[model samples]
Target: MSDTPDTPPDGFEFVVTGSGVELAVKRSGEGPAVLLIGGLGMPSVTWDISGLPGSLVDAGFEVITYNARGVSPSSAPDAPYSVADLADDAAALLDHFEVGPTIVIGYSMGCYTAQSLLRSRRELVQALVLFAGLQPSPISAMVGEMELGLIDRYGEVPREVLVFEQLLTTLHHPLLQDPATVTGWQQVLSAGYDSLWTAPEGFRGQLTASQQWITSGEPTPEHLAAIDVPTLVLAFEHDLFFPPDLCAATARQIAGAEFAQIDGVGHGGIFTGPGDSAARITEFCRARRGL
Candidate 1:
């Protein structure tokens, strides 16, 4: 799976994840359940684009991927959904599918949700993988200042474009250059925009909630300590958002957790592109689980 778009398997479905939001979900393979919690604004289809969930499925684990609330298809409720609420949605997804003791893989925002999930639903996750992850960053204040500056410059130009363009600039690690990676991300944002445009009010509400969540520097040290499951934290050396030292500190906080820094790759490369990232993740999981 070279991050090239492939023919999607036919098992994709939709179900209501808490807050009455209908979430798009895809499941495949037939072994232990491996839940893939994606970053903010991820559509189920993006998993296919990135070749992540598919590779994990090919590796003999039952893979589950879904859009988080306020993304695509998922209910962007009128009110804000707290981090715990997001984690509960994950637990509900697993419970609805009768999948337990799941191996939870959290990427980016998914990493934050996964940490929250560990505290909220400990029994559901048997193992944890934090890839290109971050704890609540101190830079939230800086980000808020930037957002304000943007607002001052470009007054009220629909949040959809604001967010989409902002993501285009900040989310992808390389920033600009790789045509394929950028195109793939565009496709994802297009899908998300289409989904959001269907209910603009919902989209607006979700966006506001998300901004609040991003700026809220909630302390989660206790939750980090409460993570008793076997954990692997893969820190990307070039990730601008999540510094390696911070990730190492996060790994250190979790008793007996393993942390490794994948050199020369940026944040997006941790999951997308033809990097050695997936192999490293697969190897770690197999060795730790003795497969």
Candidate 2:
């Protein structure tokens, strides 16, 4: 809700990447590592804003969170990077910090990257907290549905303004909250939208890349099922993006994975608001680690 990204309770800082990108990395508390990977179009600082990382820190886990590539402080390399590449970045971050057997907490697009980590580097990830992450099959159709819904809602408008408004509307869903909180979230999202629009060409490029990937449907349940680590799939009951049905389906596909539906929340609710979902996440990780 604050205009600026929330400050860390324990004061964390940047960690430089091999490619000269100084990814913002924050750490608090001390114990087995629990890495928090954020959703799309948000800085690493959002975790602080939501008080998620700090809560985990307070609970005595070595919590690590960071901005993903091409988002703010993280380097936006010219070369094309897929979800797999983003997963590699996660591994690189762990390697840089000399941490392993991590419990990964991924939300939204970060969920895709988290699965990539499990698929690519299974040994590095001990457990997973998949918040609003589901298999990619249903996701493609969902996007189309949103575009159509926007068309119906807005009737028609200039492509540019429509895209902008659509961006704003799409950014918040599944979690209806207090008007004040909604306003605050709008401010943060607006700031992010400004950043997203600043590099129009780059933004479009990324969008196109994402669209191609989503439509390709190459990353299916079969691909995700390759991951053999312990996983907890957290779904919000009213999430418009990744609904509880999809999350449960994802969990069912994974062998021995646990699934829990978070009530009275939306897609992004786990990270923000009262943070009841975040507490559940910490408990899940702690139970898995026997901490």
Candidate 3:
């Protein structure tokens, strides 16, 4: 069952089945493939909104973005899935496209999925870039617990409110200090809230997977040390969740991995703020490809 269309504009958009779920996948541009793995509960459109996808496309690399199973437009399988399950879904997309070893970029929870991909299907990866990525730690787990607890306690809080709260906490302090910027983000959140929150099962399934992954005790330092691909780890200086120090520690786990910190941004900067993250990613990939 081939999913490719006779004429796909720029690249392609189709559904691929993996791990007993259908994943919505889109590919664009014309150079080497670059797979983008988004954070937990993030839809593929977030990549477009963040300018990462368009930036990469302009930089001469084929960009691939997909809604992970349980994300909107993607099928939500039964519960009790792990980060490994998400990784498996990623691998299935790569195989479906016959993508060779390519650049893989993971953000936030997507970092966990990316690591799992490297461990399970190392041959599919040529290089790796981790943005605001972290290995699960006690502190991180506690934060996750607190966030989930709030959701459970509120019972029926507005999605926009939840998103706004997240933005306030994860966006750089400077961004928040600017009323216009903050308002812009609020508008974005308000516009997307319905699409994001309408699919309750999608959110629940991904949340369960995140909780399970955080508590799974996998991706230890030993597992991280096993990744042999050229890797770059980017940490945001003002990130509250994955502090720069811990992100650097994660970088150290990968042999020969390059680590850098994006100053004046928080955990959400890579996606929301005006930062050089996209340029850095383009440079890294170009250097690796000898472009």
Candidate 4:
């Protein structure tokens, strides 16, 4: 909701990659390291709103968050992008900060990059948390293509319609039922939709990256089973993006990965009301670290 991509929070700095890309990075608290890979078109600062980083920081882990390439203030080199490229950027960021074998958390779209991280740079991750992330769903893929098709056919979905569609899938029935809550979020989402989100082609970058993932058949069952790190697969009860069933399936694929579902929430609820998610992350990380 904040338009200050150029102005990050205290303890924030930029990490320039060998490829000459600049990543706007933020770090908080102190202890062991936890790197968070954000969702599509999601700003790193929003992690603070989720109360996730502060909660983890309070629990004795330094939290690191950053805007991926194509997200504003970070280099958006080209229109279409690859998760491997994005994961490499994440690796470079972690390398710059000298954090390793750290807990890696990914949500929604970021989950793809996180998977790539495990396959490509296993040394950087100690424990894994896949929040509302999974391989591919036919229905989800259909929706993505439909949206892109609509974009190509027409200009962009009407702002009002886009907001409505976003809510229909993002929030659960309870949040949408609250008149004041919906109105508040509608205003917030719309106000910021064009400025930092679409202005730098962030939204397109996200959509294309996801489409490419669905196309490539990444992190196949074999790939998931091959992951040697401790993994926690987290799902929301009513998430259309990555439902509990799919999340559990992903957990099943990963040897020794634990699965947990947060009730009474949707995809967006994980961040909007993050107490449950934060608790889950802390519990799993502590258990893995023998704390």
Candidate 5:
């Protein structure tokens, strides 16, 4: 592990080599450990946009974030990888830090990796917070396939444009509907896309990994039912990608898991409108810790 001068305020960066991959990991803050796993095509730095990382830090949690394999600053192997592989990377990070137990937070595609970690490295995960998570379903699989096709045809730029458009048109969140907010978001997204994604091959690798996991036929209801850890499932009311009902259903499979919906927000709400997201997560983590 190494720390450089360029590390963000109060946070230090290090490289953890495990499972034939070198992951770029960042750690910050104090108190209970909170491990954040981001969604598809998102690097750890993307979390800065959501403000959730800072909020979590202020809430007295040591926030841990990382760039998964295939993302820049992390070694990308040529071979295809699985969700379990990603979980191994997370476990490796926790081991490197010698953190006893952490609250694992997963967003969108990260939920799969989180679940894998919970199943395989239960000792490392004290609780779970799944944001906009869903079990693999036919509709969701179809959507993934459609996205893969778009990536193949138009590449990442058009795909990013399509996703931005979808967030605006389908979510109907005020943050996205406001003209000024929309323009600001467009500028931010455009300016950061290349930096965050780094390489088209890396993005394609992530897409391939997601597709493989979705089709892997694991993490079924039976599998989820086996998870006894405390879990908080937060779904957005207007998330077209993972409908609230589906998210709720997934929560029900986990024994004694708490399910909630953030009203008037969509899949991108956690980043655009983080008020409810931050509040719900902080409350859940505190409650789990019996604070």
Candidate 6:
């Protein structure tokens, strides 16, 4: 592994996945591997800044993270992609490292990939910590459809407009009510808006994947029942995209899976205070895997 100004500080190596997507995989600490799959357009560097990896490392576990196909340091598809396609990338990354059955932590979009990985490549996932996954979000699905339609009808929206919309959708309602906090979020989103502008098709591909997931009726009852491995469905209280009810249903679908909620936060709760989320996740790992 080597470090470059453009990549994560902990260093990363490019792994060629089955789809020929080069994932900039980053591994830290030394112990049982814990792979973290992030949301749409998120990169390894952003995950590092969230402090989740450092928390896990201190808790005595190796943390593996990577930028998805569309993100920089990773290959982007000229065409739109699917959730299963991203799952294939996850499976290939583990195989590339030859890391045996492992604990998986999935946030937002990562949760979808994690579920797909478990269904298609069960042997690779020992456990799942699903955050805002396994639920149907008609709102998001419709919004995703509209967003793509607009882009197709027109072209890429202005960066300023994208950043503004992201900030509004990402921050908690309470945070938005607070002038100071909302401004901080606006600045953050404005500066680090690579997810959308990085590579147009790649960004669109990620959006299309989410849209299809909602339209596809995935995680069917049979699919969830087939999952025999340990699973955790962690939900955020104020997540508009995947409300508590939606998240709870996902947990119920998975036999023997645990369901828990964090109060007073939205979809971006994980980022509002990284350590709190990390601590809860580590707690789950310790109880489930004893590591």
- Model 2 lDDT, residue 204, Cα: 33
Candidate 3 regions with alpha-carbon error over 4 angstroms: 1-12, 136-139, 150-161, 178-184
Model 3, 105: alpha-carbon shift in Å? 0.6
Q: After superposition, how far is residue 246 of candidate 1 from its true place, in Å?
A: 1.5
State candidate 6's TM-score. Answer: 0.91
lDDT of 1 by residue, 1-291 (tens): 011113323565766654566666788887878888876555566556657666777788788988766664555565444667778888889989997678888886677778778788888888888877665355534554555455557643355665555454344455556777666767765554554432443434434434555576533567667778888887767666676788888789888888888776666564444266566666655554422
Name model 2 segments beyond 4 Å from true.
Answer: 1-12, 136-188, 195-209, 271-275
* lDDT (C-alpha) at residue 51 in model 6: 78
Best by lDDT: 4
**Given candidate 1, what's the lDDT at residue 42?**
56
- Candidate 2 positional error at 50, Å: 3.5
* Model 6 lDDT, full chain set: 0.78
For model 2 the local lDDT of residue 190 reads: 56
**What would the per-residue lDDT of candidate 4 be over residues 136-167, giving only the tens digit for each residue?**
56767877787677767885656787688778
Better of 3 and 4 by lDDT: 4
Tens digits of per-residue lDDT for model 6 on 1-291?
112225433477877776667677888898788999998887766677667788889878888998888777677776578999999999998888888888998888888899889989988888899876558577678668778887888886567777766766667787889999878877778777764334777778888897887788876788788888788888778777778788897788788988888778777777774436667788877776642
| Model 2 per-residue lDDT at 88 | 80
Please list all clashing residue pairs in model 5, or write none if there are none. Answer: none
User: What lDDT would candidate 5 get against the real structure?
Assistant: 0.75
Q: What are the lDDT figures for the candidates, one per model?
A: 0.65, 0.65, 0.76, 0.79, 0.75, 0.78
Instruction: Please give the lDDT score at residue 183 for candidate 4.
Output: 93
- The sequence of per-residue lDDT tens digits that candidate 2 reaches over residues 159-212 is 555344433334344323356755666565555565542133323333434445
